[model samples]
Target: MIFHGMTVRQKALDLLDSGANGADVARRLNVPRGTVSYWLHMERSKRNICPGTRTPSCHRCDGVGLAGADYVYLLGLYLGDGHISQPTQHRVPSMMITLDDCWPGIQDEAGAAIHKVFPDNATCRVRKPGCRNIKVYSKHLLCLFPQHGPRRKHEREIALEVWQQELVDANPWPFVRGLVHSDGCRIINWTTRMVGGVRKRYEYPRYWFTNVSDDIRQLYTDTLDKLGIKWTHCTRAGKEYNISVARRASVALMDAHVGPKY
Candidate 1:
């Protein structure tokens, strides 16, 4: 009756079959109990089968939509609490990353496994001996390694030693290393960043400027206007400015907040 579109009564009668009980089957199959009874009544009268309501399953998500929308999340863990530098934090042990920082080529096999399996919006609570909860944005479900770095074994020596030496070397004046710190007291260092998209086998320098520069002069003037850094630029004594987190920004993620480096 359903296929041939013969009669409504016949279609209804056929809904109940096999060992299925009338009431339970009616509710499970989303048909009214009265309808199931009526169909049976009509079926007894006409002695035929009946069809029932039709429903389509969600093919896209296969019903996983009950949980959340499809997406990936990245969580950053720090060695110490980041709150000492910033006010409060949300979603402890996690920092949010914007989508643009991720590219398809970035994920490794291990990272892809998490992205494919972990539930969207599922929390990653970092609870390790030295773990710190510091979240950052990652569109590709990956955390950026600390660029303020000494955390990584290989870069431990280089981040502090080489970067410090480079920045001090950039200056014309001889400056003591240990005494050097930004106005906020974060250690002074050079940060290198390679320019993107060029086929050259070389990369550009990416480090903090520990010395005077025309760009930094403009920046100090601009920032001083806002933060009221009391000072005067003199042609006689010389131009010097404190490098501090309260002063300026850097291109490096960790150092981005570690500048006024003039």
Candidate 2:
């Protein structure tokens, strides 16, 4: 049985080396496509065929254009809750964004955005205790996300580059939506009101974005100001760490574009 397996594997590799795809090799060798794919991957690793050798599809290095809306949305997510890490010296770095498991729709959106930004790369989801991490590996992540550095995002200075600002300016709603999806929320507050000499209970909806990074909050408010959306700083636990959009007009605009996260 072992000799037969070795012969089949060798045949499969030979077929693959002759310029046939995994599907074609599997069909010809009467093996499962997944088996052929595994063999191909193992063979590449053995030969040290690193993915980093491939020409990076980077906007900075290759002068390639980004999917503007997707990039801006991803930028927002990264600034809010995303992280980039290099696992080892040899492997490329990966970018991860954690979203609550209850919001499968938001998870799908985040995955789609990552795929659009790095179409040539593969993305996977890693499940944690209460959230799912959508991640993609690439060598050019630093070039794409210049905010990555040695310290935590809130502890370091965060600012957008000129080109990134241009993209965000052109597509503000998506950027806001991304940020809200990550670290912001829409809630309804209730209060008592007197109407016609009678007491009544009324509820109003508002949007709130909480971020520890002052620069990140500034970026959010600056975008809001450009859109003519009124916002104020809300003090929480004796710290002004929240941006509130309680005005009816601003809430309506947020509802129209970004609604609550799914």
Per-prediction TM-score to the true structure, in the order listed: 0.16, 0.83
Least well predicted 10-residue stretch by lDDT in candidate 1: 68-77
Between which residue pairs do clashes occur in model 2? none
Q: In model 1, what lDDT does residue 72 have?
A: 11
Q: Name the regions of candidate 2 deviating beyond 4 angstroms.
A: 1-20, 23-55, 87-90
Candidate 1 lDDT (Cα, whole model)?
0.31
lDDT of 2 by residue, 1-262 (tens): 2233888999998887777887988788888888887777677667655352224488888887799999999999999989999768747889999999878999999999998989878899999999999999887899999999988888999999999999999999999999999999999988998999999999999999999999999999999999999999999899999999989998999999999989
| Candidate 2 C-alpha RMSD relative to the actual structure | 4.3
Superposition error at 24 for model 1 (Å): 18
RMSD of 1: 22.6
Model 1 residue 178 lDDT?
12
In lDDT terms, how accurate is model 2? Answer: 0.89
